[model samples]
Target: MFTKSILTAAALAVALPFAANANDGQAMQAATLNVDASAFTTNELAQIAAERGDTRKAERAARIQAQKTEVPGVTNAGRDMQAAILNLDPANFTTNELAQIDAETSALAKAERIEKILDEKSGATVSTSGVKSLTVEYVHHGRDDA
Candidate 1:
């Protein structure tokens, strides 16, 4: 409906200048159809109408053709769900730890694997003085189950 109105307004705008210059009295009478020239897209037309001291038409036309925008396919719910699924927090762990967690195939298996690792002995200390064998001290704050 709005599109048809715009097309009609455009066609009238195209023919208006010639119509205004006609010499016949009938043409002069036709010119007084009471339609304003500036009634096309954008607020520019409304601005023109206002400058010509027709505030009522300017406001009316402004309301009719106000700008509206929307993303083509993305709904608010879809966007929110995507955000929630991808929202991984890494504040408590290092990048290596995060990579280890990400390598798990399933959530239940991942949790079980982490639990088994945490249950093992970690951060065991050995005396370094006169030691023939090297003692590798592994400080495990969390699981290293990559």
Candidate 2:
């Protein structure tokens, strides 16, 4: 019984780290999903609602579209598009900055431009060292807009 107990403890010691890593991975994936969900543009939401036959979502998208209050110097459309692309809040950036990002034809280009703009604005390199890499999937809704 003592030998069996020691073996079980040893096995648990080996497995505990793996279990912890699995939990971390799951948490990261959940966070990524949340970002992706929130990154959907109003048009994208509308398209998704239509595809899923979800009237409530469709109506909500419509309401969001109708309720857009333009910021004083910000172009709402460009800001919103860049915000969705970067999985970031639109309020954090200015209209001109978002317009530059939106002008990028691809997601990767946009991300790079954002990083550059941030570096230029802050005068310091943004550190992403501790951030775990996540796969982002972008869905194009047959729009010319990136």
Candidate 3:
């Protein structure tokens, strides 16, 4: 009907301005992230990453990351770092780029050292009074070599 067509035209008029605004937002976002992709060659980044070494890179990363990482009531970064602190693969990230990522992922810097016990038992029984510690009795049923 003509009424339906008129209502549609009115609605489109109202939405057209919003659509233009949305396009403008996208343009602004693209401009914000317009990084020069060719600043460093792949080989240059790899060499820099290697020269930085794992320890220095991790330390730098931790410092940057520390800003974003809030002080949790209890965090064991030492243990986590021990496991996670490996030389970053040069293929994925450049040494020059760790600071930004660390800044964003700061929560990882405040990890505390943790103690881990790996006990394998054959026939083990454990009893706990509460959540703190467990009284464990491990029995090993092995062959009797007399």
TM-score, one value per model: 0.20, 0.32, 0.22
Provide the lowest-lDDT 10-residue window in model 1.
Answer: 126-135
Q: Write the per-residue lDDT of candidate 3 for residues 11-57, one digit (tens) a residue.
A: 99999999877645434433333322233333333333444556764
lDDT (tens digit, per residue) of candidate 1 on 63-127: 44432222322334433343234233222222333334446666655444334433431235332
lDDT for each residue of candidate 2 in 1-146, tens digit (9 for 90 to 100): 99999999999999998987764543453353332344455344434445434465556555444434335234477666756765655665665566666788776776777677667755776743311232446887796975
Worst 10 residues of 3 by lDDT: 112-121
Candidate 1 segments whose C-alpha is farther than 4 A from its true place: 1-89, 113-146
Leading candidate by lDDT: 2
Q: How good is model 3 by TM-score?
A: 0.22
Q: How far is 118's C-alpha from truth in model 2 (Å)? A: 0.8
The candidate that achieves the highest TM-score relative to the unseen native structure: 2
- Once all C-alphas are superposed, what RMSD does model 2 give against the true structure? 18.8
